[model samples]
Target: MLVLLPPSETKAPGGDGDPLDLAALSWPELTDVRAGLVEALVELAGDLPAARAALGLSPTQDDEVARNAELLGAPTMPALARYTGVLYDALDVRSLTRAQRARADRRLAVGSALFGVVRATDRIPAYRLSAGSALPGRPTLRALWRPTLGPLLAAVDELVVDLRSSAYAALAPVPGAVTLDVLCERPDGTRVVVSHSNKAHKGRVARLLATTTGEPGDVVRLRALLRRAGFHVEHPGGTALTLVVPADWATR
Candidate 1:
């Protein structure tokens, strides 16, 4: 099974691995587009004010732009190790056993604006670019990615679990992939879509899915696996599952 994860805005800086090699990344077909974006970003970085404006950064986030400037020369690390945030924090990949980490490397692929999609083991450098950002002299990133990325993702043979946030998902959509939603159940039986803690729940679910020996080929098996992992999973509709948490889930 393949799990598509969203890339985090905040990434762990520096790495021990060699600099990123586009030819060595998972999708060689995306190299041209990747090279294009890298050139655009590198050029933009020469003008910090323009780069900052293009990346939607404030004064404090200038470091992010600097990171972009050094994207080509910076040391790299596995994509899974590079990303960080509430979701990744919950994933806690650093704590996984060797076998589990191997499984994660095989099953996970992160949606990226600059690289298209990177496998868990793909080497990447610390850089700042959001799927929503419009680089100078380029069409929308969605436009740039959709032509190549969509076909590539749509061709995946495994049951794909798409957990990307809307922006990244907009870049490339896996046809018929099961999308998950985390909801909060109130005492009165009404359910509200989880906002703050949703990433954490998705992260946990991803960790469970990643570590398991079972391969869930469809929504049914996927639901079963999540339930087995102690999550309150419900099939709400077509190709979608809702993981319900208590209303006070965040506090807990």
Candidate 2:
């Protein structure tokens, strides 16, 4: 789905490899995602069945959040509903009538676009860190790098801008990349890291490595190397990537 054949201008001067799979989602899928969001919003707003009736949704709307989250791989439908409710309240979304959710959904849609879930599978052997503790920095932050970094980084940066610095990662198409750039939140020093991944596959690939961490305000070197790796990487719009960091990871 990511690659839908090359773009119109492959040999042309401005041509950048094939177009990514950022096409408009199928209507049904969009509807499913939207419906899930609406239901979650209504439920969070108060009244469950009334929200469903108001939205013209079916009983299944009750399960839509979980269902949609599972399909979209988002946190959870209820979680989304809860977060979205928060966004709505913050932005005064509840009072906005029909015209508003339509407009606001655009931003949510962009958040969806920013995510590249396929990349998760690539980190099967990734280092796991607890929620409270730091994700490792500096010396311990040199393990996450992949060849796909060249093709995926820029998109991710754009996504970070859209998601406002929310959590994001990329898994190479082939998962054969030599390194990884993990975004973590440490207490004392660094906030993100770029290290060598695929160590378990070392016997098969031989380019085993470690990791590196840095501040969101300064990851240009890492971004450039990832681009060189053939990944269409982009530094997240400062606001976007920074916005996504967890409470502990955020500027403290």
Candidate 3:
């Protein structure tokens, strides 16, 4: 089973791995799109002020523009280790067992604005690009990615558990992919969609699914697997499930 994760705006900078290599990345069909974006970004980096404006950055974020300038020659790190945010902080890949980490590498892939989708083990450099950003002399990122990404995801022969945020998910709609939603349950038996803690809950779900020996390739197996991992999961028809968490948990 493949688990699709969203990329974080905040990433861990610097790495010991070699520079980015398009041929070595997964989903080879996306190489052309990735290459085009990389070239556009590299060129955009030529004018720091213009690049910062195009990327919607404030004056304090000048370092991010510098990072973009070094995209090709910068050191790289595994995608799993590169991102840091509410979700990634919760997953804490560095704390996983060796076996669990190995399983994570095999089952996880992150949806990126810069590289399309990168496997957990794929090596990538530090770069600044938001899924919503518009580069100069190019179409919107969604337009560029939609054509190729949808077909590539649809062809995958695995039960895909999509955990990407709405922005990244808009780039490619995976056919038959099951999406997981995080909800907070109140004391009065009411449930509301979680906001701030949504990413944290999804991260925990990803870690649980990644470490487990069970292979859930369908809704039935997926629900069962999450239940066994101690989640209050509910299938709300179609290809989506809701994991109900305690209201206190979200508040915390």
Please write out the lDDT profile of model 3 over residues 1-252, one tens digit for every residue. 999999998889999998989989998989999999998888998888889878999989988988988999999999999999889988889999999999999999999988889999999998999989989889999999989998889889999999999999999889899999999988998989876779999999999988888888799889998898799999989889999999899954
- Per-residue lDDT, model 1, residue 109, is 88
lDDT of 1 by residue, 91-132 (tens): 899999999999999999899999999999999999999988
Lowest lDDT sum, 10 consecutive residues, model 3, at 189-198
Report the C-alpha displacement of residue 66, candidate 1, in angstroms: 0.6
Superposition TM-score, candidate 2 onto the true structure: 0.22
Candidate 3: TM-score? 0.96
- For residues 1-252, what per-residue lDDT tens digits would candidate 2 score against the true structure? 111110010011111223222132322323333343333432332554544443344676455422322232222211112222222223333444555444333322212211222120111111111111112121111122223232443343322212111122222122221123234445554555321111111111111001112212233543553344443343454321121123242222
| lDDT ranking, best first | 1, 3, 2
Tell me, what's the RMSD of every candidate?
A: 1.0, 19.1, 1.2
- TM-score (all chains, Cα) for each model: 0.97, 0.22, 0.96
User: Per-residue lDDT for 111 in model 2?
Assistant: 20
Considering every candidate listed, which one attains the maximal TM-score? 1
Cα error, residue 129 of model 1, in Å, equals 0.4
The number of clashing residue pairs in each candidate reads 0, 48, 0
